[model samples]
Target: MTRSINEVRVVGLGKVGELVALLLSDSGFTVTAYDARTRSDLPFACKELDVRDGAALRSALTGADAVVSCLPYHLNLGVAEAAHDLGVHYFDLTEDVPTTNRVLELAGSGEARNVYAPQCGLAPGLIGIVGSWLAKQFDEIRSIELKVGALPRHPAGLLGYAFNWSAEGVVNEYLNDCEVLRSGRRQMVPAMTEQERVVIGGIELEASLTSGGLGTMCETYEGRVQRLDYKTMRYPGHFELMRFFFDELGLRDRRELAGEILVQAKPPVDDDVVYLHAAVEGHADATGERAYRKQYVRAYQPLTINGRHWRAISWTTAASAAAVVELVADGRLPQTGFIKQEDISFVDLLSTKNGALFGDLGKV
Candidate 1:
């Protein structure tokens, strides 16, 4: 049985971790904020510890009931391993499929005392839950499309893009092979292919196949849907710029260097928008004449947390991660196993303190 109030420790004090700690604290959990960097504004017990240091990580999680990771994808495995050994629940915001698979393997060790959940952020996180919610409404689901983006409200650069989140995660997705299910068959699609333009809120935006956005949806919907795909939304010219860099310039082979270049050139922005779009199409009636469609559109602006206002991208990502941890602490989730963001029920998610962030965003 899950306890009433969990003592939560957050690793990473970046944009995502800051909001995660804030939201968890606000939700009545005993929150502790841990980071190598110093942030005077954050609430709860604040400590300086590097999660990459396995010894330090275990020490930091000593008495904590749960650990929520807001670090980049590369740093997740160590923390997950430590969580598994320490018998504490683990959660993270990662879109890396391989990293997620590793976490799942670790979670399945059967010796863990608590749950291990990854991909608890925007696309893989919220989109998975939204897709699962729609799947339940249809009997013969045929197709599912998910489009999500963290974009700048105001344009400044040639790409019209902003670095509101992790540069490493973004670069990895751009370079890696994307997974998609076509006609009930799983295959690899080159990243940055299948470019298209979409208008959201009367604003014209571009979208295309990006790696890792689908999370475990491809496997979850493999046999159920004839077609399943996921894409990342960006400004009109972003895809063109990326194609030139990854394909023409051959930066795909040098992802680290490419990420360094982008970070040095294009930094994060404060005024940004987080947009999530999901649609599931299938038959509703037994006659096979009725078509059913369910869509979820959630948008978030810059918000304040722990008395520190952060970008919308940070808040959304961090808040989403925090919500997963809150659920596990409340015993709403599995205690010892691999947990996907889709495993979360939409109804249960939106009702929580941090989950309420999606309440104001109307249904699409």
Candidate 2:
């Protein structure tokens, strides 16, 4: 039987981390927030501790039922290891493929006593869940496309974009190779290529190849689908500006410098919108002769929760992870194992209080 989770330690108190800690606390879980550089303005209990310090992390997680790592993608493996050692459930919002592989390795080991769930964020997390649910609706899946973007509600500047989430994460996805299934075979494709124009919510946008957004869908639908890919949506001209920097300026080779430059140039905006779009096409039923298409599209904005305003990205990312954690606590998910975002049922996820914030039930 799954044990009740009453306490949780949240690592990294950044924009998304702060919201995660606050939302978990609001949901009746005792939250202890930690960060390398602690903030005094956070709403819940917080402490100063570097997650790299294994001893300190274990200590912080001592009596907690779970530890949620909202740290940068590169800094999550150490926390996952610490969680394994302490026998506490491990969760993270990392989109880094290598880091997730390491977490998978840790969870697969016989010594692990708790669950390990990575990529529990916006794109790789909720997007994957919705994609998997749509795929299951078809009898012979032909193709699946997933696209998501956290864009400023009122875009400004030359790029027509603002840093809604992690600047480093944005750069990483642009530079890394994206995995996709083409013609019923899995393959790796260069990022920022295959640009296409799309329209969502009466707004025209552009999308292109990006890494880590597919999560495990490519593997899950490997031989089942003829085509499967995930892309990042952006306003028109955004892709050209990024290409000028990554290709023309040769900043792709210097990723850290690129990230620094981008962060320094673009200011983070609180008034942002999280846009999600997914479509699946295949045979509708056993007839295997009819083709049908199903799609999901929604735009989420900032919300007032408990007298405090939270950005769309902040709440969407944090709520995705928190909802999964709640599912585990309620014994709806496996108590001790490696959990994938695609393993979650869409109805179950949307039923959670935090997940319901997306609004419009049965619309998608």
Expressed as tens digits, the lDDT of each residue in 295-319 for candidate 2 is 9888888877778898888888999
In terms of lDDT, model 2 sits at: 0.87
Clashing pairs in 1: 114-335, 115-335
lDDT of all predictions, in order shown? 0.81, 0.87
Best by TM-score: 2
Put down candidate 1 lDDT per residue, 236-285, tens digits, no spaces. Answer: 88988988987799877887888888877878878888878888888987
lDDT of 2 at 300: 83
TM-score of each: 0.94, 0.96
Which pairs clash in the backbone of model 2?
A: none
What TM-score should be assigned to candidate 2? 0.96
